[model samples]
Target: MHVPDGFINAPVSIAAGAVAAGAIAVSLRGARRELAGGSPTAGFEDNRTAPLGGLVAAFIFAVQMLNFPVAAGTSGHLLGGALAAILVGPYTGVLCVSVVLLMQGVLFADGGLTALGVNITVMGVVTVAVAYGLFRGLLAVLPRSRRSVTVSAFLAALVSVPAAAAAFTLLYALGGTTDVPVGKVLTAMVGVHVLIGLGEAAITALTVGAVIAVRPDLVHGARGIITPLKLRVNGELVDAEAPAPDPVRSGSRRAVWATGLATTLVLAGVVSYYASANPDGLEKVAADQGIDAKADQYEHATADSPLADYGVKDVEDERLAGGLAGAIGVGATVAAGTGVLWVVRRRREDPAAPTHRSAGTAV
Candidate 1:
């Protein structure tokens, strides 16, 4: 749910901005460790984290356009926090979503420019923190298998949607511009988002399951859960050592990236044309509850942008205009995300060191 500018007053907006900035700074430092492999023996293959993170950001941008119908009138799309965290590390996951938000705000003009911090805090920080925290906890308690990891991802994503709704409710309560009753708003936001969460859960599970099926090693959440091969030595079973890092894996990684990018392109450029046209959860709730009474005063600063409202400004064909915008958005998100991750990766203390994790070791 992208909060518009007029929804919140200046003081609360500034406060939220400060919080978002601090979280981003902390995440950047944290990302260095994750991108560097989080261990001394991590192989160069761990370098895959950076580009994979970029792809995750672009994929989120693509999927967010596909607003699946929830209730009769409302719809919801993937927030992607749990999916990103499960595939990449949590810190990188935060950066991934943030990159998507930035691209949407600046280029597509989907989210308000002034409410950037609020969007990042609610959508980026809250979702990742809640989903990743719950995911790790569930993984700790559940059976140590790939299935458990997928289940945890599903549950975490399911809860994260309402968690984000609650966060927005709290923010509105603190500094809402309109005089709407907080109780009704809270109930409606959470209620609809719960149904949306089901969609979120399914998508997160399927994506995580698909990734795990092919390359469990690249999935950060599946790292410690997928058991390594064990050999019987004189009637006693022992954990087999991890195989040597292969040179051929680089080509394999290229293939993975190609497949992922192709999927993202198709989702945004072609499939998005069929997305639900009804209002999303937040927009519907705001309209139904009169939370956006003052939205007219604070119009989007980028309303005049060529790609405003997810369409090309002068394009007559709705489908073609939207398709071009979505395609452009995907490319912009990938480039921005990759550039940011590359900078973060460059800041590692020992860039040359291979920080490899043993097979089946917890991160």
Candidate 2:
């Protein structure tokens, strides 16, 4: 959930900000290894990984805008932690969700500026960390198959939402702006979020299964799980020689990117129009538990921007204005996310970097 301003006191918010910043810093470093394909000269594959990562972020942003009805009065959406981690990697997944939160906060005014850290901590760092950990653990125990990977993704995502909700409950216990029973709030938050988790699980499973079907190599979590075909020799199974890395097909890459971008645009600009209007898990919980009684108004410079509240300011047609806003959001998120990830990938490839220098000096 996008935490608005004044939900958390200044002290806890500042602490969460520091935590979020630290997590991002660490993720940036980890993302380097992931984007580089686990080697220094991995820049050759950057063309494939970098753009795919950006597309994942954009897709997550668009899908998140489409909130599906959960219970009678509540709705839920994809948090994207497990989906991104399965498609990309854990570190990159955190970056992807952070990028979405930043874009939503600054550009769309969907999340509050002051609460950026809270949103990042709860929705980005916590979700990614928990989901990816569970995913890896399950992958270790499960059979080495695409189905297993999808199953892990589903379970990981299902648990991550409530984990994040629990984190938020702990944070609110420390810095909530209003006086409310922490126990009841915790119970309600976790309860409602569990329902939301079902939706998250389904979306994650479907998406991961689809990617694994098409390009299992592209899925970070599925790596090494899809083994080479074995041969029976003398009634004994032998590992087959691994295939060579396929040449980069620029046309295929372009096609996939174009198709993904088009799908994101369609979802945000058209499908989102029919999304459930009910309040999400967090909002419903807050209202029911009286945690939002002292909620402060969202006061940001861009609060009055044309695209604020996911609608154009002067556009009279609600549908058209919302569609334009969604389209713009998709474009902006892709551009911003792609640029950030490109820079990170390039930094990893920097030959003059300190790590390279030290290694050279040692040699």
Clashes of 1: 6
* RMSD values, in order shown: 5.4, 3.2
The digit string of per-residue lDDT tens for model 1 on 1-363 reads 888778988898899989999989998988877787775335434678889999999999999999999988899999998898888888899899999998898887777888899999999999999999999999998989989998999999999999999999999999999999999989999999999999999999999999888888788888778878899999999999999978898888889989999999999988999999899999999999999899888778777889988898899999999899989999999989989998988766566867889999998
Highest-scoring model, lDDT: 1
Enumerate residue pairs that collide in model 1. Answer: 41-355, 41-356, 42-354, 42-355, 42-356, 43-356
Candidate 2 shows a clash count of 0
Summarize candidate 2's per-residue lDDT along 1-363 as a digit string, tens digits.
888887898999999999999999999999888888766565555577788888999999999999999999999988898888888898998899999999998888887777889999999999999999999999899888888999999999999999999999999999999999899989999998999999999999998898777777788998889877999999999998877765665676677789889999999999999999999998998888878877755476578777898898899998999899999999999998888889988786566755535545655
Tell me the TM-score of model 2.
0.94
- TM-score leader: 1
Q: What are the per-model numbers of colliding residue pairs?
A: 6, 0
